[model samples]
Target: MSTLTTAPDPTSETAQLVRRARRHRSRRALRRTSALGLLLAAAVVVRVTLGDYTVTIPDTLRIIGGADIPGASFILMESTLPRAVAAVLAGASLAVAGGVMQDLMRNPLASPDILGISGGASTAAVFSLIVLGLSGPGVTMVAFLGALAVAAVLVGMSSGGAKGGTHALIIVGVGCSALLVALTHWVLLRADVYRLSEAMVWLTGSVAAASWTEIARLAVLAAVALPAMLLLHRQLRVMMLGDDLAAGLGVAVERHRALAMLGVVLLVAGTCAVCGPIAFVALLAGPIGRRLHRGRTRLVDIALIGALMVVVADYIGAYLVPGGGNLPVGVVTGLAGAPFLLWLIVTRTRVET
Candidate 1:
């Protein structure tokens, strides 16, 4: 018995390699995640402390630590800090929303903006501002409702099963985007000049007026929506291997997919409502995250990259732009993202879906 030997399973080598590859990918994602987090932290610090007013690091820390140091406190806690925090939360929400959209549509170019989710929110937000004379949370609530309505329409129209559903969804999304754009323009055309300027600026997106109350509310939204998306990640990954295979593996593909979409819609609406639809944070973050992770998207990486992107963009818009007036963060993101979008279209010959 002692002298008898057993052979390893025939598939052991392949299984081991697969496991090793997975581990490598996980480690790589972890590295990038950490780097992204650090970068985001640095960005937040810079945004909070190094603006034109230039709050010293110690005073900034004290301000964060709840010191009421007169003018410094007002600048730090009321203005800079809230704006920075809002940008981070909004960015993370948009990025995670993008990742979910890509998974659902199976298209790398898919995002809240492209699918008209942002358009819906923007339309409602502008209407509430100019037509209804609503401001603050009222506009945000309208935007969220508008986003949900658009997402529901999309899900309803695109549930034609897997074969042609994706294509139909893409077509419908583009149409929705165009229709929404026309509607937005029509609404704007009817606006008074004074309100039109306000609407235009809001549509361009700015975090400068971010209030602590708004930040608190967005933080709560993030706490719920982000976790929900992350919880569905493994399920979504399994579902990627064809519907039949996913069903065989015991995933309720339709249910989970719908759930994921709900989460995505919530996230997109929350961010758009809070800051208007800051363009391209959702579009760019997922692909960059996937490239860094060397494969499928990691929600954390996507979130971190997105947060950093918006924070940096906001910083530029807020302080670094040539004009003394604060530039809208949306404008900055549009400027940075347009070239990248062109590059993506030219380079990516075949989109998976």
Candidate 2:
């Protein structure tokens, strides 16, 4: 009766709170993933089934499972399947890359397309195509190299070398992008008609020429990069709290940031190599994913949303364009993203005011 009870352990309570928070985040992530997964599945079904050939969903499934469904088999195997796969891979890769960049930079406007990474890749690929006469994987390799080079340049130009603030990096990136885009245009102007036509279509970004080879390449890249990014998510979260705090919390800010940049470069380069810089999937995916999940941004959800966007956009370009000719997926995404970009600027201005 005279003795007082011991107080509860603060460490134990803190641990419990952390566990609860983790559990809540896990549940939220699962729900978001499930919803986005269903959307992606639907998009894939529509992409394969409702194309110019019109394969039934059942037939599409059967064909995918190695059943020869007579008329649908060839179409599904040769064109539609590869195209759909390419769109999904390209979109997911770009989205994840964009999400990583935005998270690292702590800027909604930061993305491969906006920050000159894609432009660098595109410019290099175009140069290889027209000036150097490189073909096949050579162009892809050059694109990758170009992207890495741009990343290096951005880092150097930033205020604190590789650990600079978001604004400096973005500003430098925009300047670099403008330069690269000008070079791309100059290259286009110098090309002969046939080569120019090919480059133009590629620059516009289409999965129309998607093949099994391209799919396999993307699959291999994703197999390596996606899991690595997932593992780095904790570090990314810490990094989000600013370098000083992150470093104080035992995060190697520069090293982790460099690693993240490498992953983003690989992803962006790979997608651009295959799909030729499909516009805005990277730029829009992170924000859309956040909105869909009630202001949470999970990389997997963002990737799925990006995949859905590309597939749906491609479908619309292929079958729904007012004029008969198919437009590039890039064009559709560009049209969509431009408005969103304007809205972002307006809202940001209003907020600042």
Candidate 3:
């Protein structure tokens, strides 16, 4: 019997390299995810236990476990708990939305707020609040519809088909955002003092009045949307290599892109409905998450980081301000985000130069 020897396939080395790279990325993502998860948990504990009306950790644990602690019970159940939950959900949603947008567009500057989804939702919400006199669930429904509509218009305007038309998308989105913002201002200007004040607070963003109903609504939206995004993770990773490459790999580029945009819209709309447009959480979360994981973007890490940012910012607004009066969470985030934005612009300019 003669033994036949076959030469090794030349592509095996490349395949091995690809597998190794993927495994390395997965390990890094896992480590970052674990770290962020722990940090987010700690932040939530701190947020719930430390406030104007402080609750000890043990007492908080007891309250969570169904123990009836005196002063802590009402405050925890009604106020701190709900607010913290809202912060986490809103932050995570915004961050995930932003990450998806950035990855889709391959533009660091692309975020739901910047691309007009949040603005559209805010405008619709304000109209519902002031003109239609809608509140609660009605406003949320309007906001969701408005976001979806704007996203559809944006995608159509950009012609983001098999190839992601990022530049056109950005231009159209920014213009639309400007128009929507102007309309929101006009609505606010014509409103009565009481309505104006309430609208302003909502526009500026706050979880101060967070309720169980709002929490439940956000929870449901997140439950539905986040898993969908996760399921699209492989497509997202593939698309990062460019549309043609992604399409060649058996990914339906346009379809996946549209699905990703839908997921982003849902996240942003739900967040806006619950807490209004909390500035820069989405914009900042992706970059921060990437940095934390040594420049690898993991969706879960981004979400956790976003949650941490919002929880910490809310804590500052509620407790760290000099006066007894609380600031809106948006105000704190805006203040923080503006500087970061400026730095980003300057750095980008430097890089271009």
Candidate 4:
């Protein structure tokens, strides 16, 4: 009778484990979504509370709801609100771009900044300023083209390498970035003092002067690009399993990767054109989202985390600067992101060893 007993099938037990894992992941995603909503509410409160003349949270709510606060209306509408909106948009856009790139490349360190998107935009913007004296939309247009060109070069190089991998892409991007940085500095040194001042602002990145016009331009660009990004989300997850696995799963590996790269290029270009190579928002957001959500991360969560960080950082810079002049959010992000970058490098090296 004891010898007649049988154990459960191993495959059945494995399937059960997978189902449980999927359920856990789903629950985690939902909790993260709720947390993100709370963080967004907090960000709005903080933004409304900080300024030369702070508004009470209740009054800020009224103002945001379109009720007029006579003396504060102009400042709130024309300056603070627009700037806050820009920060939110820029943060979310960059973060989404970064998360997509990381997943597509299957590399923790992959980001728009790392992949030469921002550098490409910077090179073109600098050229427009120093060579053609172009400003406004013209500069942005050139920058957009530059980002496309650089991304094309990167993909081309990566595919042509002996063995295709994320490393090749990163290497090509880093090489291009190094060359572009040198050229940008040269252009800056050669420009007149006045133009140099303008270029300086572009290089440092600030959304302080965002207008309805600028926001509209970004909105239009995002309208075309955002949906494209969302379309790639599932394919991008498949892509994380490597080209062979993705292909086996019915993904057109090369085609999807190319299209995904193009989408990120458009996103980075659109944001960089308006905000001027915002430094570390892209680099930091993906990890922050992962940390917040635990395990797998969603595109929306990453975007929300990025947006929240940028707004909070801007608020900090506005308050911390002794003379009341705000530090560019890019600079603040760079400072905060450097340590994270260093840690990634160290951990990566240890893993390799």
Clash counts for the predictions, in order: 0, 0, 0, 0
What TM-score would every model get versus the actual structure?
0.92, 0.92, 0.91, 0.89
User: After best superposition, candidate 2 residue 88: deviation in angstroms?
Assistant: 0.6
Worst 10 residues of 4 by lDDT: 155-164
lDDT of 4 at 53: 76
Clashing pairs in 1: none
Model 4 C-alpha lDDT per residue in residues 1-353, reported as the tens digit of each score: 36776888999999999999999988878887888979876886677667787777787778879999987877677877787888888888888889888887677788888878889988898899789988678877888898889888766765522156778778877888898899899988889998899789878878877787887888787778777787788887887776677788998877887898888887888788788888878888887777776646578888888888888888877777677677887878888888989998898889989
**Candidate 2 residue lDDT tens string, 1-353:** 69989999999999999999999988878987998899899888888888678988777778888898777898889877888899999999999999988888888888988999999899999999999999778888999999999987765554243444677788888999999999999999999999999999999999988778877988899989988987886798887777789888998878888888889889988888888989988999999888876766689888898999999999999899998588889999999999998897798679879
Count residue pairs with overlapping backbones in model 4.
Answer: 0
| Candidate 1 residue spans exceeding 4 A from truth | 1-21, 162-165, 350-353
Best by lDDT: 3
Q: Give the TM-score of candidate 4.
A: 0.89
| Alpha carbon lDDT of each predicted model | 0.85, 0.87, 0.88, 0.81
For model 1, state the Cα shift of residue 181 in Å: 1.3
Model 3 accuracy (lDDT, Cα): 0.88
Give the alpha carbon lDDT tens digit for every residue of 1-353 in model 1: 37978898869988999999989877877777788889899999999998778899999888888888888888888788888999999999999999888877777777889889999989988888888999778887898888888888777764546446666776787899999899999999989999988778878877877777878888999999899899998898987776678889999978887898888878887787778889999999999988886667789889998999999999998889986588899999999999998888777755533
